[model samples]
Target: MRWRVAFPGICVLLLIAVILTSQGERHVSLSDGVVAYFKRQQPIFAEKTVQLRRHIEQLQPGDSTSLLAARQALRECRISYKSIAFFLEYFFASEAYVFNAPAKYEIEEPYIEYEEPVGLQQIEALLYDPQVWQHRPELAAQATVLVQTAQDLHALLYQFSATSAQVTESIQQELIRIMTLYITGYDAPLLKSGIAEAAAAMKAIDTMLTPYQDLDKKDSIKYYLQQGIHMLSTQPDFDSFDRLSFLVNNALPLQRLLLNSNHDLFSATALKKDVFPHKDITGDTALGRRLFFEKALSGNATRSCATCHQPERYFTDGLMRNRSLTGNEVLPRHTPGLLYAAYQYSQFWDGRVQSLEEQVKAVMHSPQEMNANDDTVLHRLHNMPNYRGISLLQVQASLAAYLRTLAPFNSLFDHYMAGNKQALTDEQREGGNIFMGKGQCATCHFAPLFNGLIPPRYNRTEFEVLGIPAVDDLTHPLPDMDSGRLAFFPIGFYKGTFKTPTVRNTAVTAPYMHNGAFRNMEQVIDFYNKGGGNGIGLSVPNQTLSAVPLQLTPKEKKALIAFMEALTDRDPIAH
Candidate 1:
């Protein structure tokens, strides 16, 4: 009896000690630690920028030795900047743009007045072109601009103060961004240092995440980080790196672990905002929901967002293509379901816009859609009895917010993946296996989200050249004349390429593909089973989809459809 009483007392003492120890560790402020890290990195980046500028200045026209030295210096500067890419991109997006943007500019309708390229990439482009050596003044001017930008970025770091949520979100976002952009060669298209750069990015993330170590499961996160670093380090080259394996084995697990750690450190309420830095809407407000369904924002009194994206019909109008504003002609593309739309990096069938708000603005002004400019829409909204004095920006923000709320991944398949095995039938399970393994669906569509955005990171959306037929009739199979992504990018490889849409709610969002040519899931599957348009005797030289026939049995095709149907989100939109 005495021994039992003594053991209980000892247990209480041990519990008390653990609590005190945790409290002591908590006092070390994660926010302060992150701020200090950036402070240290800021000066390093600045110094490198200065060094690169000096190298550019020292360059002698047509001298190969001078050119090589300058190129090496510029590469060093880029490497230093890449280490803090996550922090710079998250905190100072606009300033980050000044550091690196595409060199090319469009001169037509969507008229972006292209600024002179002025960063490491611009310098790299100049160094590679022997002819550009004659334009020494231009090179020096761009180098000066890069130095100033770096200095400005350093100064901004002084004002940086991270909340626990922001730090966690930023790290998570950067991981995805690295996977989507860095690994895919989107960021360093010219340099082709994707492998080395990805490793550097992972190392930087390791440094940034060091402060939150106490919040993580002991040794759990460290294991994944080390594994990721090791895997990336050992890779021979960018093309040979097993991206799928890395995402499945290392990155996805790490993301979940970090997310859980963040959840443990911060309240869910605090973390429930835009993951991006500057967005105004949180999508949790009643005002946003009201604005989403409001007709006053439209030119036609009866038409609103709900007119095309009906809530009862899984957010699609349930048409091959929705009728135009006048109801006389059909819109160019099928109305993509807004459910899970927020998860995508770009918006629209052609991916013409980046932000959700920007997409709203585009739709509102399109003559075939809302047919109302910002000014006219705002005027109508102000005159509404319930929405008096609403600004155009507010309308856009609210709509974006509401659209984001529609993206809840609570499907039966999600439940099955979360460990409730009974959530899926035997056929559905087989279908999933076929989808992931034999069908080669996961290679492009990815898992969980099952979209081209790619998982573990979800940083970029992919457009694919499928060589889709213009119509369902394959008798004389003509390639779709509607140059999909080529309309925007005007590149030969982008011909017939369309943004890969999410299959989350494919059971309902019918008449699939950008053109809504396929009437059912069977038709869509048949197109893929026979190896896309190329296998059907159409001359598609740049088809991204494999021309080799899948040879999936009819039963296998039915099972695939069953699995997709299971992906339908179970949760109802509260509004």
Candidate 2:
């Protein structure tokens, strides 16, 4: 009975001690420590802005530096190309929030009795307000009081933009560290108490005072606070190609449009039709697609896809050496003009890629191409003004949807499809017959779209080994060769196999074959006339090219070339 009575007296004595500590002076430094940090970071941001502006000023239309910057901007702009894909994953893929808890110091509410370390207790009081309990009922129910308390620190960060990044980052780190420590039973009340005072002081003076901020309308320190804290909270993980593809193809809407200036035909083509109606079209175009096209989408400070695939000359760069983001020569392959590529099931001469979007991704990330990765490109895009809420996945999907509208098969040949009689000449007619018969070009290059397909083509991509060697090496063909489809599959069957390309714009896509080996139509015919590539010295183990020769005379060769030339139409083939 005496021990129980003494226990109450001991509790009262301890309560007095707690009150003394709770009302004590703050240990935290605001001026010298927290506020001083952001003041220093301002110049770094300013310098970066200045350099980019100067570089833009120096950009002469097609200069490399400007192009790189534009590329970066484009990459940033495309984050919304999908939706909140990454956001959804971070938000819902897991059951827990990145930071969530409440009641930082569970029982230590300020009252007549004091708590240890006045600054820390004040912070805890702010975090553990009765309003906070009401505001976060869901958290409170789960006893996520600690989580709410931790999250409140991030909220404070957003509110405390007056601090320098160094200060902001330091405070953020401190909050996270303390939360972890507190969770692990560490004593850190003094450290936190001091930080609360620092926050109050910075919030006091972080606004623009007089004349300078007026010209630029500078944002309050809080703007940086929100942005900085939001940025720090985000964590990214790359999805696999299969998963990424599924997410993109399913989650995002594909907007198909007609770049064709003729609105009537575009309307007719886009309209519901019997044979070739497009089920994929959402019947929309980006209001500013032409802006994107002309502006360059690389997101690096460099070249656009248009830099290579120009609309004129059938969508090629029309340059011998394609410049890469690293400002280096892109060796090996010439840029294929973007004509009738919609008919192409495979992309690249070696057919290394499967689709236009995949091809774009390849070029964007290639060291000798755009010389960038997805994140590097996306970071550049995120810095832009117009791209405020867009995600990286959205941008990729948008760009891809744009590419889908590049189908222009309409030439004089399309006129023939419309039942025009005089579009073909006698020579072209005779050559067409030969193409179907003895010429045997039509055996590989089929009709309608002329690109290879297995009648309503889906996943099937065909590869035949056509041995067309370098001009210099006619006699001894080197096996130290780029074996096309063999590179992708790496099997006995795939050796020397390359995809069969559409003969549609064959006239303009000069220097033919996977390696761009042949210079003229005559050379191609002459080689074919002597049977397959094995007729020369270069022989693979299982060559599927015609062992039987075309045996064409000079006239037949010229006539066949004429037929190919007639296949050329104006850019943006009429639907």
Candidate 3:
């Protein structure tokens, strides 16, 4: 009787164990789920494209009603496109460029002949303008191109497939991109439709992650997503929106959580090699130190690399412009500090070179700079008994290696971002808020790096047309005469454009701007407050800086300066 009772109990326990085991073995594939979701979105996007084309076709000559309809249709199309933005940007990057690339093209991109702006942005620029009626045919042509691109995007969605890791990584990157670019009004710079588009993107993310709701930590992730969407939905005006709060509270924490949940899926993708790859020699070593300070690399041994890049003054020569090797003329531009130069994709004020090694070669070969050719440099090094076997290539590699080690990101601000609240004082923290919020510094400078390398990818550097004054006097202003990027690009809009340099050690590296026109940070702040050269009565048609005054108060201006000073890195190696 006892054996019979025990057998029944055993059977019940065994059945429960089998069910639990089966449940444990079962795994829902998120990759397949996401693929299905993308496929579903294809038809919706196609229909929206058709609607956009129809609206464009319905444009009657000088009819406000028809134009209004067209604008509405265009906004609807943007909304539809934004719904699948994360997937499109990740899987179809090249094709997506045709959908909404920047209006301007880089001069270095020789493969693209007659680089005219095409895509949604091109159409939007025309449609939104009051003068669009005058250029109806041009607007119509751009609309047709947008229609075809949207169709291509729809077709391409069917070919999309991603691993779970890829999906997770792409989502994480998209979140960061949304906060950094989309929220900052970069994507819809002319339209000011950033808030609406951001909402659409958030909705899309919610939809994409819905199928994976049963995963571990789903509740917490869902909470963050909902909170972010709520924050975006309730945003005030574009200018007054608390971007600092949004970034620190909503966006950043959400990104961290998402990344942590899929820690195993995250890995560094292969970065493009610098134009000239250096051997594994870091600057902290004795050999790298020797190469960096070596004067033999110069044709005239009167100066070394450290001559212009003095370690005592935060790697800057503390001059408006450095004297040339001949000591008769000055270099064209101000000497930019080498503190965080390694993080940039391109070097020099014009962004003509691709690597630090290439920059070294250019500087050495230039008559105004070091004035040493590769052969001459090698010969000089060969004559030195200690450097007898050193080649020109080795010199380049060693110097580049040393410069790469100068990327010190450990500022008090960096520590604050990493989680130490006490890293900033009340005044500094308030100033930081204004910098990101009212001042609009974060839009161009970006975060952490305070450079225009554009995060989440950081592959390409950016150039901006600030229209800095020819002289410091605002009352009698003239545009800086340097052709700047136009010297190399030869494009009309690129005239006076310069690469955005880092403000990392700006406190120490005074005499700001490419021309070193500003004597102090106060002057720089005042210039920006007055809305760059254009606002100060200088004729700069293509000035990228906003023409509207920042209207920063004396207190706020002081705070902004304080925040910049906080970015000063603790030197890893003092002279």
Candidate 4:
């Protein structure tokens, strides 16, 4: 009788063991799960897109209620897009631009392709204008186009497939997207719904990561995601939102957790291939350093790269424009600092060259600049004890390598982002918020690099037609005559277009803009506050900068300048 009673308990234990074995044997495909998640999200996104278009169709310019309804619909559409943005953007980047691109005409070089401003950003620009009635037809048309693209995207979603590796990689890229674009109000400048969109994106990432929760034993990623979403949702105010605190406390920790969990899925070496395109030579840094200060590379043998790019002034000469080779006239454009030059996709103000090596060679040969003859320079280098066997190519490589070392991410602002709360003051924090929100500086000067290199991909650099004045006289300004990228590309949209440089060391690198018209950060801020060159009454039909005044208070402007000042590197480049 006792044996019979034990037998039943044994059977129960055996049954439990069998169930556990079956559960362990069943393999869950993360890729399939991710694709299915996207399919479900597509319909939601499509419906929201249709809703936005309908709201726009019924919009009455003078009707306040209608306008408010349309704005709410726009917010909904943006949030829905954010939910699946990671997959959509990673797979269909070109098609994705149709749904949300910048509100300006753009020319893609090499192909000479022209793209008109369209999508949600274009609609937002029109709707948020004080004179919405004036742009009624344009707003309706943009909304209609957006709905059509959404339909196309929905159809394309049926064929979507991703490897488990891609799913994790996409999540990582989305994290970068949130940090760079979404939080900065890049896409939703007028609506200021970037925070909400960021939350939606994180939620989607959290859902995708659910299958891997067991893999993350600590569950730190889930905790941070929830925390970040809560903080974003609670803070509705765009200008006063504490972005620094959010980034340091939540977003950064989650990023580290994800990166550590999936070391095999993403390799640092592979990502560096995208970031630093060229093959970086080993054991050449010391040689490159010596060549950077070598005066013999120039035609006159009087000026080295350091002469124009002085280390004392953050690698800039601190002039409106440096003197030409003969010292008879000034160089055509302003001498930009070399502090973070290597981080850009393209070099120079006009973005004519795509590599630092190419830029170095161009400067060496330019008559108005270094004015060096290849044979002569090679001969001079051969005589030097350290650079005896160096060819012209080696010289170019060395100089490029040296430039790559200039990026030292130890600024006060960087420390603040890295979790040092006292690195920034209250005024500096307010200034940073304004820069990311109302000022719209982050739209062009993206975070981390704070340059024109587009984020998430970082494959292309952006050029903008700011329509800079020839002088600082906003009251009686003249449009700069410099053709910029147009001189080489011969495209109408490229007129007066220049690459956006990093503003990291701007407090030290004075004489701003392509022409160096603005002498100080205050002047530059004022120029932008008044709405670039177009708002100041200059004739610039192709100006890409919005012609709307920033409407900043005096204190805000001072704080903005102070925030930029805080970007100065902790370790000086002067040795």
**Alpha-carbon RMSD of each model:** 13.7, 31.3, 11.9, 11.4
Q: What does the lDDT come to for candidate 1?
A: 0.67
In angstroms, the error of model 1 at 127 is 36
Give Cα-based local distance difference scores for all models: 0.67, 0.40, 0.68, 0.77
- TM per candidate: 0.57, 0.48, 0.80, 0.89
Higher-TM-score candidate of 1 and 4: 4
Candidate 2 regions exceeding 4 Å error are 1-300, 318-324, 327-330, 350-353, 383-386, 456-459, 472-480, 573-575
**Which 10 consecutive positions of candidate 2 have the poorest summed lDDT?**
1-10
Runs of candidate 4 exceeding 4 Å displacement: 1-27, 152-154, 157-159, 214-219, 261-274, 277-283
lDDT (tens digit, per residue) of candidate 2 on 1-575: 00000000010000011101122122123323333343443343234323433333433433556445522322221121111111112223221122111112111111212212112122232223334323223322222322233233222223443222233223322222211222111121212221222122222222211111122332322343322223222311111011112111211111110011222111224221112212232322361243235333554546766666666656665454455566655556556666656445467765666555567667766777666566755565567665545554455445555665666656665564344547777677556545544455643554444544322111233456666665525556554366665576555455666666777777776656655566666667776666557777666545545444666667777777877877886565232
Give the alpha carbon lDDT tens digit for every residue of 1-575 in model 1: 00000000010000011111243345346556667777788788888889887888888866888888887787677767777777777678667766665332212223323344556666666666547677578778877887788777657755567665565556666676555556655444445565567777788878765544544554466667777888888983654466545655676567657655322111212122244222554433466678767776667755788889888888888888888989999888889988877766678988777778889888888888888767767777677786787677777787787777776667887666544668888778767656654565655675445777543334446667787887887657877788886788675555687878788889877888888888998988888888788878899876766666778898889988998888887764753
- Please give the TM-score that candidate 1 achieves against the real structure: 0.57
Ranking by lDDT: 4, 3, 1, 2
Over 63-175, each residue of candidate 3 has an lDDT whose tens digit, in order, gives 98998888777777776777777787877776766666665443334332444666666677677666878767887777777767766665665556666656665576667
* True-vs-predicted CA distance for residue 387, candidate 3, Å: 4.2
Return the TM-score for candidate 2, rounded to 2 decimals. Answer: 0.48
Model 4 per-residue lDDT tens digits across residues 446-509? 7767877666666566788887999988899987899998887787777898988989888878
